[model samples]
Target: MKQAVIFAGASVQPEQQPPVPAADLYVCADAGVKLAQALGVVPDWIVGDFDSLGSVPEGENVEPFSPMKDDTDILLAAKYALSKGCRRLVFYGALGGRLDHTVANLQMLRFLADHGAQGVLVDHAHWVTLQRGGTAVYPRRDGMYFSLFAMTEQCEDVTLEGVAYPLCHGKFSNAFPLGVSNEILAENAVVTVGRGDLLVVYARD
Candidate 1:
């Protein structure tokens, strides 16, 4: 059961990076090499098309791809992590900067979920993940905001606990953001989905 951490291009400065996990491997995707280096991280592999890299990093394990590829660099790095038998994947630098890239990384979370590998996009201010037919629980904290969106067309039998607006066996629609801007009121909060998928966004602002 190996774990992996991937650094992406759309991120903040190294000094402002989040607390990273201790994993078997660390990866750099395109411009992520810069972030990795700035944080004094020697990644096990450097992956991407090298377009945003400016200059190829000095490394032996470089997995280069074409600029015309279908997947984004972060997704490519995630695939590499899966190929190496990683069961848990955490992505940094996948959020912030461009809205399109952030959306793309959310899709990568779906890919990880479909493959039975858990993945999350994390930063100092936000933590995002995908949930499908499962339950996700968190230790509730005051001033933190939690929201859920239907990842599929709709999420069925959704349950919420310990939140300002709690729901039990509720249905959420992608066309509507009915589950937005909720706050904690207890020690713990749980979100359960009996059908479909949900995009969970937890933020502290």
Candidate 2:
């Protein structure tokens, strides 16, 4: 499986830019082309409605969409990457801007998950993703916090291990943030969800 790195239009400080990962494909969505230029990465594909970008970019790979379309720019980029056979996607500038766009990007994680692909939103201080009904392993990071929340109404038979507060066969609901701000105590922390979905976050303090 190949990997794709997508640049989104969300605002991120210079200090908040994470190290760009190597990818088989690089995508820029709308104003994300600016971020890509700042990061010194030339995009393999550029796509968007050109609203945030102000105008269509000059490139043969640039794909333009109708501004009235339902999909967000980042969504269009993600779909383009998927069509190119990239299974693992890493998105930069996908969070921290308008609240609605941030929420919509989170839903994109679910969209990737449902399609048997892995997608993550990353910034300098955090990594966020969604997990379906399955087990996931996370390695401990010094001075970082691990948190999770039920994306569905409830996540059943959720088990957590190697964390500051561990749980076994527990139920987590979206109404309460029971899994917030936990520390990883072991080399690897494990999370298992028997049903529903989880929004997992790893944040730097």
Candidate 3:
């Protein structure tokens, strides 16, 4: 499957990182250029204000935006990638920056999901993604903690298994945080939602 990988400007620890995997397109958001280059990525597009770059790199691959624009640089890069027909996308350096930017980046995952693409937000302590409605199976990581949160008004018939606390056919709402900090016990864990979508956060302290 053709996919895109984007790098943003967020603080990240070396050890607690997730791989961006192979992608058909590589995009960088301002300072994200450094991270992308460090990962040996040749970006097809560099979308952002030239501030982080000192000056725009000389290439047709560059897409400059006004720093004062309403959208964040990373969001702009993502939209561009999607427009170019990338269906599966993953982001690095997208969290741990300004709190508001981090939250906005997470919200972008929902936008991608609703538009028929998959978006994953990978950071030092967690890997997060939005599920419109489906099952997600995860291979266990010893120190990882799993949590589920309703992304819409409500998520119905949620089920979780192979974890320390298992639930069946549960309903969750945005008003309350009913699923948070559950342990992974075995080789794998499965989460299923019968209606609506939820945010699945696989985290560690």
65-110 in candidate 3: lDDT tens per residue?
8888988889899899889899988998898888998889878888
| Strongest candidate by lDDT | 2
lDDT of 2 by residue, 148-172 (tens): 9999999999999999999999999
Ranking by TM-score: 2, 1, 3
TM accuracy, model 3: 0.92
For each candidate, C-alpha RMSD in Å? 1.3, 1.0, 1.7
Clash pairs, model 2 backbone: none
| Top-TM-score candidate index | 2
Worst 10 contiguous positions by lDDT, candidate 2: 9-18
Better of 1 and 2 by TM-score: 2
Higher-ranked by lDDT: 1 or 2: 2
Tens-digit per-residue lDDT, 1-205, candidate 1 = 7999999998587777777879999999999988787877889999999898777666579988889999888888999999999979988898886999888888888889888898888877888888888887877755669888998999999999988999999999999999988887878888899999898888887
Q: Could you estimate the TM-score for every candidate?
A: 0.95, 0.97, 0.92
